[model samples]
Target: MMTTYLERASHALALVCRVVAGIALVALLAVTIADVSTRYLYRLTEGAIALRVTGSVELVSYLMLCSLLAAMAANVEKSQVVVEAFSHGLAPAIKNRLHGVYLLGFAALGLVLFLGLVDSAQSAAGHGEVTQDLRLPMSPIYYAAAALSLLLGVRSLIEALLGALFGRDAEVSHGE
Candidate 1:
């Protein structure tokens, strides 16, 4: 019963990650297109593209950052690579306990990374760095990406923990 619930919840979260990744990719593409078009228009005219492309071009970095984070989340949710050779040889009970311990360690590591990201965001904000033309703060975007990465790490930890506690949804094989 608990396994069923956890699997369903994990599936739902994975779906959400897919949607977010798709949206971020689309947004990045649109921004890139705009940047290109503006640059071309400026080339056709005088060398006045700086005014049109300055601030908007800078946003490309943020958009790309977002896309990468979203894609990473989706990947982690859907398919995580692991070396199963050792686990396959282990007894079922031992395998479950080992998996549980691994997930707990990963969760602890994620917590540390989350704290570091938060601190970095705070330090960046305190420094008051702004975009060249738009004067928009960059810390927010960094923090958002960091938060997404943290969420992905946490979600993976949860999935692993659940699988370790309950029997995994998939059949276990001694062979690859």
Candidate 2:
């Protein structure tokens, strides 16, 4: 019963991350279009409109960061890529064990990234870092990314455990 609840919660969290990623993608597209249009109009009118979107580069960078971070959980859960070239001839049980090891390694990497981001966030906060044009605090973005990294780590670890215990069957059933 507890495992079922945890699985549900994990699924919900992954769904939320996917939704946020979609929203971030839309925002990124809109911002890029607006920035391009503004630049084009400014060039065409010879600065008559005076409508160049300031801080557009910074905004796009933030949007991209957010989009990537938000997508991590779902991407980790989904196993979007499969390299069967080497593992194709391997026994099913061996392949599953190797996959489990791979997931565990991924989890470890995510944990390292999460720790690095936390340190970066703290350093940014201490230094009062801000974007050049918008003066947006950099620490918050770092912290958000850190949170997502932690989530990805946890999800990866969970998937690794399941893969180890139930092999490929677990992954197929859990959509991992």
Candidate 3:
């Protein structure tokens, strides 16, 4: 009963994350398109006068990066694309064991990503790098990406571990 509750809660969280991330991605795309159009229109209106355009591209890049980070976390949760081609022939117990091994691997990956996050944060601090136009410390964005990646890794590990320990319903929808 506890497992079921946890699973349901995790699924709910994934759904919310997915919706928010998807909206951000769409908004970023629209913003990028608008920026391009605006710049082109400005060039035409200005007529051979080059205006020193400053931050739109940088802003767009940061927004896109953030969207990508969010999307990745959502993708890991809605992991539907499993390779069961050979697993079909295996016994149930063996399949569960194999899945457990996979979960361990995912946990290891999570550890690696967590370590990378530390390194990235330290490097950013040492360099004092900031965005060209926004002047925001680039370290924070890197840290955000690292944190999201770690979250994704943890989600995968949890799914794999749960499936291995309690088995999984093949019919359960992996929808975020």
Which candidate ranks first by TM-score, i.e. highest?
A: 2
Best by lDDT: 2
Cα lDDT of model 3 by residue, 1-176, tens digit: 75576576557655655775787678777777777777787789885644443576786776676676567555553334457897878876666556655665655676687679778888987999888886888788778767766766666666666666666531253432
lDDT of 2 by residue, 1-176 (tens): 64565566667767787888898889999989999999899889999987877888888898888788778766674663557898779887777666667788778977998999999999999999997899999899899888888878877777666566556433465565
- The whole-model lDDT of each prediction reads 0.65, 0.78, 0.66
Give the per-residue lDDT digits (tens) of candidate 1, residues 65-150: 67766665554433434468777687766665566555555556556767777887887799987767689876786687777677
Q: Can you tell me which runs of candidate 3 are displaced by over 4 Å?
A: 46-53, 77-85, 91-100, 170-176
lDDT score, residue 63, model 1? Answer: 73
What's the candidate order when arranged by decreasing TM-score?
2, 3, 1
Scored by lDDT, model 2 comes in at 0.78
TM-score of each: 0.71, 0.85, 0.74
Better of 1 and 2 by TM-score: 2
How many collisions per candidate?
A: 0, 0, 0
Ranking of all predicted structures according to lDDT, beginning with the best and ending with the worst = 2, 3, 1
